[model samples]
Target: MRVAAFLCEALTRGTTHAEPLAVEGNRLDFVDTLRQLQPDLVINLCESLAADSRGEILIPGLLDLLGLPYTGSSALSLGLALHKPKAKELLRARGISTPAFAVVQRPEDVKAVDLPYPLIVKPAHEDASMGVDFDSVVHTPAELARAAIAVLSTFHQPALVEQFIQGREIYVPLLGNAPRRALPLTEIHFGQAFENRPNIVSYKAKWETESPECRDSTSALCRLEDTALEERLIQTAVGAFSALDCQDYGRVDLRVSAEGVPYVIDINPNCDLHPGAGFAKAAAAAGIDYPALANRLVEIALERTHGNPSHRTKGPGTARRVDPPNRNVLAGRGPVRHRAGGPRAHAE
Candidate 1:
């Protein structure tokens, strides 16, 4: 609700109108509505379709079919980022640093996992830490099997088991294209409540606000003690963003090892833009307030209409989908923002 309202406010900042257009199901209805409405632009905030995370990729694909210019990453990028193993592979292919990870389909599959014991287990296809919990971080073989099985059964997806980097967890928000600027870094702060707890941003830590995990963990602007590590963090984050083919705006999450090496933990395209989101906080740190950040995203998408991937993807007929003089209110799909970890299930 806040995501759509804020985006609408931002779109209307310059006389352009925007409105929330939630799709409660029925793809045909959604399609017919967009065609009839023929919106000049769409500020897409949806990370899923019909409550299914995998369906998020189809949202952009649907918008493209309607020939409407929408803000954020493309269908291909969203798909890659939503599937953990695929995104990690792309990062590795680009020579980017990501924690060693394996996909486990069953409890027995944990045996084939050659990674270290102090690893994190999570739903391979879930976002917003939907299936992640304090138990997700395991230190023993038994713990690993339990965690993997929990994710596999609960989320109905394979489990992603990976080495858990022990260090600072940082979030780098990227805005714009060609230059894809990285905003000031933000890190998750653990308070006294986390004293005896494992220092990890679990699902409860990110979403269950009333829970101790969430209360103990807070997101704040962070400056690395070592300036050099800061730069590497930014560079590696940008590399991950580019490797995932994210556009307009996104967030790259990382856990810097004690050795100061930054490992790409997750790449989120079309990241949450709520005023209180991590991406928004980083943007605010860089002097791009929520409203201006929203404005910039719309402008970035518009700027790409000339021979860019967006334009080419729109194809010839979709050219008419550009900002027409009769452009009505910019429609949007709301309630897709991740209010917890703050992503498109953002890694905390």
Candidate 2:
């Protein structure tokens, strides 16, 4: 079956050099291109969309409009996962352990939310460590406020002020259902001096590939952990996944406190799938190579489409059922409403 990958042009740039047949474009162009191709499956790897600009939900809605079968979580799930504060609230409400966080729209808003310091400030709506830096960990409320404002102004979004958990940073990759398999846990090990600074996967640490802070400080060390603790991490990660309603494949980032309790920092529904990325690395650890992983995602999408291809096969006279208005023709004003035991008349 023919497969089309929908990803941002920026991500697809280097990819074409290795895979000459890969089609790449910006989000809108990519959607149009995919429509023209009409491929059996579309792998959506585009991180952010224009609708995400103002926090408007777009991903799943667009896919529905396109009537295309695509891999990963639906638009509702993606939108929910993208907003960190909302995601955390949902997880917390569901009895899942997550880092305590406060949302800050302005610098002054920081004082109202009394979270402990050495707090971490990050763009509330961004992922991939965007707008996070070494200075994101603030030891004082004033500094926290300043960092929050900087993030809000720079990223044009609210700031997530969270209590920084200093401990082992672990990422749990998950795949499939009925019995979801958690791949080997990957840890971020920072050297001694950097220990004072909370083990943060900051924006600089993530994006600035050539920065000295990264070169001199952190390392992504996999295959290093005790068996019992590793099992706990996987269990907690799975709990977070179920709590968030994440589907297909994704990754959950966590920090194990000194006491060994795993606190979820983030749940990524549409994580990076590049061969060099963390998700792919974890899949490799589970003995599923890059191509096999990609194909599995496609398989999941096809399964979903098989159940509901109405969106894909839409045509004239294909209109589905709709509930009629709540009014009785005989009454002319309103319909009789039922309240458990009896029917009652309601005015228009």
| Best-performing candidate as measured by lDDT | 1
- Candidate 2 clash pair list: 60-75
lDDT of 1 by residue, 25-63 (tens): 535466777888877667777766767888888878988
lDDT of 2 by residue, 144-227 (tens): 878988998888889998989888788888886545788766777665536556666665456555654454444353564467
Score every model by TM-score. Answer: 0.90, 0.76
**Could you tally the backbone clashes for each prediction?**
2, 1
Best by TM-score: 1
Q: After superposition, how far is residue 227 of candidate 2 from its true place, in Å?
A: 3.7
TM value for model 2: 0.76
Score each candidate by Cα lDDT. 0.78, 0.63
Candidate 1 has an lDDT of 0.78
